[model samples]
Target: MERKMIRISGKRQITIPQKYFDLLGFDTEAECILRGNELVIRPVSERSGGEFAEAILADLISQGYQGDELLSKFKETQKKVRPAVKTMIDEADALAATGGSTASLDDLFGTEER
Candidate 1:
């Protein structure tokens, strides 16, 4: 991680180093998140949930949605992608912490008959 000793202004704002800001693709706005005792400032992606856009559009289109309805459904599904991914990540982390499943390959898939 890159470390910098930056001074905070009287208004409780610190200037991000140009190198870091450019590297992180910072624009006019940033998302400030408090994780534990650490404060993280990240660039706010203009295209949040954009990764799923093509797939969502394809599915919605195949489902016979078009016009304003297609656009509406696309927006709704796009909003859901991030939260759903977060939930999956949380679940995965929990499983990892618990050592995941106990079943072996044989137990799960069964062995060939002798």
Candidate 2:
């Protein structure tokens, strides 16, 4: 285990140490949860892609994908999907900026209007 002391700046930003970054492989972003009187900083990991990976894996398995082949395929799929998702998010952001100060599900993701 490793330990370090950190100070919060006037802007309320604390820089996470490089030791922790190297150990955890988390970059730039984290989720801070206010638990009672204490603050819990958890890394926002994109490694697994969780639900997206699961859905893709299920579909691939149905098509006879498995083992190292499955892993390779999933990674390849990730490379392809990430950019498209980013584009959509960029478009959503631009739309939101022009329309309002916020992006809603219906405007950004084409969900049912509320």
Candidate 3:
């Protein structure tokens, strides 16, 4: 196809010709890509409509697959682990609550008093 010349305005804006727009199915929301040395403009497809970051986040969300179910499962796992963690925390708190009186360096070293 023969390409037509377009004039860049003072504001550095190029007016895309109606013919090219119609041929390429370009709309007001179309995206333009400028590679190393090529300028390509095309209509955004459903599969590629969003910004790259949005697309990546969307893909990550989609891959999560279980949505609320996964969240519920995680909560369930936390519930199962909570008691053990709490027990450990309680033990540590009790140890700390001793005020270090029973935590002698000899006790730590498992040795008799010199």
How high is each candidate's TM-score?
Answer: 0.60, 0.45, 0.38
Best by TM-score: 1
Residue 51 in model 1: shift from native, Å?
0.7
Q: Per-residue error at 35 for model 2, in Å?
A: 20
Taking the candidates one at a time, how many backbone clashes does each contain?
0, 0, 0
Residue 25 Cα positional deviation in candidate 3, in Å, after optimal superposition: 0.7
Top-scoring candidate (lDDT): 1
Ranking by TM-score: 1, 2, 3
Q: Cα miss at 36, model 3 (Å)?
A: 1.6
The residue-by-residue lDDT of candidate 3 on 1-114, one tens digit each, is 777899999998888799887887876667777788998877865432223434334444575736776556444444444455446556655667777557754443335422
In angstroms, the error of model 2 at 70 is 2.7
- TM-score, cand. 2: 0.45
Per-residue alpha-carbon lDDT of model 1 for 50-114, expressed as tens digits?
A: 99899889999999999999999999989987877677667665666778677455444446542
CA lDDT, every model vs. true structure: 0.84, 0.76, 0.60
lDDT of 2: 0.76
Query: Model 1 reaches what TM-score against the true structure?
Result: 0.60
